[model samples]
Target chain A: MNAIAPSFPAHVQTGALSIRNLSKTYPLKGRPVPVLQGIDLDIRPGEFVSILGASGCGKSTLLRLIVGLDPDYQGQILLDGQPLNGPGLERGIVFQDHRLFPWMTLQQNIALALKNHDLGTAQKQRLVDEHIALVGLRGYEQAYPHQLSGGMAQRGAIARALVNKPKVLLLDEPFGALDALTRVRLQQELQRIWVQERCTVIMVTHDIEEALYLGDRVIVMEANPGRIGEQVQLELAHPRQRDTALLFQHKQRLLAQLVGH
Target chain B: MSPFKALTWLVSPLALLALWAAVADAALFPANLLVPPLEVWRSFADLLATGELQEHLAGSLSRLSLGFAAGALAGLAFGTAMALSDTVEAYCAPLFHTLRQIPSIALIPMLVLLLGIDETFKVVIVAKTAFFPVALATVEGIRAIPRSHFEVAAVYRLRWPTLVARIALPAAVPAIVTGVRVALTRAWVVLVACELLAADSGLGQMIEMGRQMLRIDVVMVGVAITGVIGFALDFSLRRVERRLSGWQVAGR
Candidate 1:
């Protein structure tokens, strides 16, 4: 695999996320039902962390909290040593669905994220073009979401999320809706992009192989009032081969732990 | 369209015309009541040549445009307000719903008494007819917007104006446009009915005059023209609706 050099300017390292004793509950039939409890995690800048869990595991909920979508959680989520407020431009996220405005073309959708940024029109256009190219979606700028294939739309979503140059990027099962072949292809593309961007990434997924393949550290979570179960650290380099025995071994170990649960 | 498909469209009209000719030939009713199709056609040509049809049509169309514009614009504003603000909804929704249930025709008598049988009465009635469906659709459309859309806006940190204009309006467009289309056709029908009840000049007034003069062929001409105009209005609006919402995938 040819590794592309990072195209963005080298700014001071900033994205370091810390979640301490985070707990959340949703009201079920008038009583509060615990969804997440006592979760503590500290992530360094430029780290790729994959959170592996089953359905009802609250993994997605954890991401929603960190992204500041829902502010009804208990605990301190500090970003770069400062208490995080509601969603800021520093954090970007991609949901399972592409969520592109159907009325807008790919280029327009990506440009919309820069609506609040203090940049000139030409500068915003450059950022949009660069991100679209970064996601390998050149020559498809004028296509609307419906006109694009499922995988292409998801790629467009990724470009939109990255256009703002957020310090931290979150992905919630970003490939969950794709076919097996498309999912695999997008995983490769995601790996390549992450290697080049080198931003802090936290992805939530149930696919063990995907987690082991991309994550610098994999955190396994258990359901029933979701909590961390175990952690696995992968001492691997970028542009790593997908079919390596090391990846297979880690996948097997994670599978055994999850199946045993 | 294929030649065969185009031929199929004419089948029903031809069948109806043949049936009418047979009935008239058999003298199933009085000749004056069921005028021959040829006589009606001649009357249509005479009205066209004299420009009486054009005058009545222009009068009716102008009323429709003015009334529909005022009513649809008000509906859009009021509906958006009701959807956005709980206080507005709470105060107005009940009265709005109750008023909507009463047909515009029912209000014609009261409206005539208040505003007289003039252009104002017809315009007011058409405006009232246009408002209800549009307001209802706007409320429903805005409410139906998925929460996911709002979440995306939140994540992007979009400001208020951006959020409303870019997100909310576009998301609710298909519904609002559909509502406007319904309101327009409904207003046209109500405008004609109002003219029928009382008008110095209009297609409806022309039909009434034909009835008084025992010119059944003229009445038939007016009826045919009315149907054609209504159909043209609906068909054109449908095209606009399809064009505006071309982004929507079928079955989605």
Candidate 2:
């Protein structure tokens, strides 16, 4: 932990993100099918926002559009009042599947994210090492994704996403595939990483408890034309207890909203 | 390699050899018709010492290498293009499938009639034998790569070359290696058949000459050598293939 670390790229800028009247639609059998519609939201710099919804609710689709994986959408996604186009180094995403290239070692997978950056060899190595440490994967740099357990692989994915020092990190159910124990463990790790790095985070998940656990604000979504239904703000500070009465009340309310009459 | 493993593999072949020696000694068939195992071994030794076996093996291997290289390379390029682009797939898929269905051996007579029983004909037969499985493997490999993998590449904004090298190439390597192994052994078999029918200087030619001269021992030597060479080629390639796709096994 006392290792001298090379600084992030000076050009990297963290910014507040705004999604205004954002709507995405795909043609199904030559008919327009809307996924995300008239979605308006504002996220402060360094805030963690979790969007909650059921399957087909376009929760993942929204994350895809935000990460610039799909550019053919209507409306604005602005970072610091500047419209974002295609994918860039400033935006990083950890998908549900971990998505690490199986042939590459964990270090190579993380190093690959920095391919477009113009850092020196030493700086790149330092950043890769630091992030690997940040996610508590200190000694697993040379392991392949296949050799890792599911939680470790997802952590590798998170390290890869964060190695570029992005302005915003988009996680599409980053811990969706892990067991309940591992998922909860990673949530605590993510909360610590978020506090240390101070970058804006937007994660999409279906779990109500996960939404309230780490998010400063949880955005509940409705399906069949995915759009925001409600928002719950947790004003508690960092490293709050998971079973607090306030969080439990919010979880019950959210559960009703998610799977209720 | 452990001595026990080596001994275990040798057991079956030794049993077959013992059976062969017994049949020859019992004289169920005439000596000329079913040559004794010792006579075959002596002839094999005689050819090796005189370097005739080396000359024939060198000729056969050269043709196999040339033809397999050309065919496999073309198949790889064509298969990748087809997998990547609908236009390429639409144009080439039908013709490619039809050509693959026609076995390389079946084409030997027509090819000999058209191109004559020359080095070119034998090489063409080998190439044809190698092409289909390689192409099919490449296509399946590329197609089998998940959408999730591509999404990761897109998210990172990887350039065209990096995307192909890091993601596409390795992901498809296991299937392509398997395909190449199948093609290599198939091409060797087809090449030997072509040589037996047409060429003047290959293992198949040696066997053909022995048959014509009624020297069953020489022909038996060629048959044994062909089986051993094919087995060695396949075994060697499988090692290479496993190395390339070691990740697949580890993942399981």
Candidate 3:
């Protein structure tokens, strides 16, 4: 492990992630039930944005749409200047389940993301190794997903997602399955990684505290034609202190919005 | 895992064997009808000394290999095609299911009539016996693979060859291996039965010859040898199964 924490890269190719008049509907018993309606979100390059909502909210759907995992939607999603039609290496996703291939070791799983990259073998290995180390899973490169704990598996997933050094890293409740202590530790570890990588991160999380802790701006969402309820910007700097009053106040207000009087 | 532990585990089977031996030697039925284990062993040694047993075994094994190879290859291709295309599945599913429902043993007489009591007939029966289980397993295995896996492959923009080589094949390996094991054991039994009914050579022929000649001891030897070979084949297949599915055991 490096004693010197790597600094965030300053010269990132800032891609404007813009969603315009986005909407989604599902066919329920022959009727179209709208999930997300007339939604607009613009995430700046290198910014950490967290979407916080209740269980039935379309927060996850929004992430899926941006990641191009779900393409059936009515509106334009632009990453930088390119139209988002399908999934690409530029956008990486971390699912709720670790989704690591059971047969693959940690290193192999992460390296799979770089399968299409036109890099030399040594360079590819270097990136895989670096990402494994980045997620604090340095020595566990050869460990299978089944051999690892929940937190460790999720870390491996994170490493896999970040191995590509994507323009945007979409997280669909990545730490939702972890225990309280593990979640907290991962949240901190996530911040450290995000700062070092400086990739635009949009995470969908139900936990208000988690959103407040990780996001530069936490967007509260409401269900039943899911749309943004409110947006709260955390003025607190990066490498955030967990118990800060700013984080606590944001959490309380976000909770109020989520639980609606 | 200890020898003593293994020995304790065998107590019931050993007791049963001893009881069987005692019953056979009691002369309750004619000694000629109920051949004793010692006499069966003696017959087996005699056959071995004359090279009769080895010759029969070789003949049976060669037939099994040929039949099983042809059946397994066809089954793998057919199952994969069925899984890949709804059109193929729709056209063939009912016929496939109906054929699978007919036990291979039940088809022996019909197959013999159609193909004659030649080598071709026995090979056909053995192949038919091996085919269905493997095909059914392959289809189920392929279908059981999550759509997410394909989506991952698509996201990476993997070519069809790469996808099959890296993702589909490995993901379906456990099921495919299980199918192969089932087919192997099934094929072994079917070959012996066919040989008993039709073939002039092989272990089943030897057994049939012994029965006709009224050598009850030789008949007993045939039965015991078949049992042992069947057990050995299953044991080896199980070892392969465990080794192939090592990942699954780890997950459990």
Q: DockQ of candidates 1 onward, in order?
A: 0.63, 0.72, 0.52
lDDT of 2 at A93: 92
Candidate 3, which segments miss by more than 4 Å at Cα?
A1-10, B109-118
Question: Which is better, 1 or 3, measured by TM-score?
Answer: 1
Segments in model 2 whose C-alpha atoms lie over 4 Å from true places: A1-13, A26-32, A243-245, A259-261, B1-6, B113-116
Output the number of the DockQ-best candidate.
Answer: 2
lDDT of each: 0.89, 0.89, 0.86
Per-candidate fnat, comma-separated: 0.73, 0.76, 0.39
* Residue B104 displacement (Å), model 2: 1.8
Tens-digit per-residue lDDT, B1-252, candidate 1: 878996897899889989998999899999899997988898999999999999999999999999998898888878888886899999999999999999999898899999999999998888888888888888888889888988999999998778778887777888998999899889988888788789999988889899999999989998898888988988898888888778874417
Best by TM-score: 1
Chain A TM-score across all models, in listed order: 0.95, 0.94, 0.94
Ranking by TM-score: 1, 3, 2
- Model 2 per-residue lDDT tens digits across residues B100-163: 8988878877998999888999988888888899999999999999988887888778887787
lDDT of 2 at A191: 86
If you superpose only chain B onto the true chain B, what TM-score does each candidate give?
0.95, 0.96, 0.94
Q: Write the per-residue lDDT of candidate 3 for residues A127-203, one digit (tens) a residue.
A: 99998888899899999899999999999989888988888999999999999999999999999999888899999
RMSD of each: 3.1, 4.6, 3.7
Give lDDT tens digits, candidate 3, residues B1-252: 888986895898689789879999788888888887788878889999999999999999988888988898888878887886799999999999999999888988888888888888877877887888888888888799998887767666667767766776677779988998889888988888888888888989999999999998888888888888888988898898888778878887
Instruction: Report how closely model 3 matches the true complex, as a DockQ value.
Output: 0.52
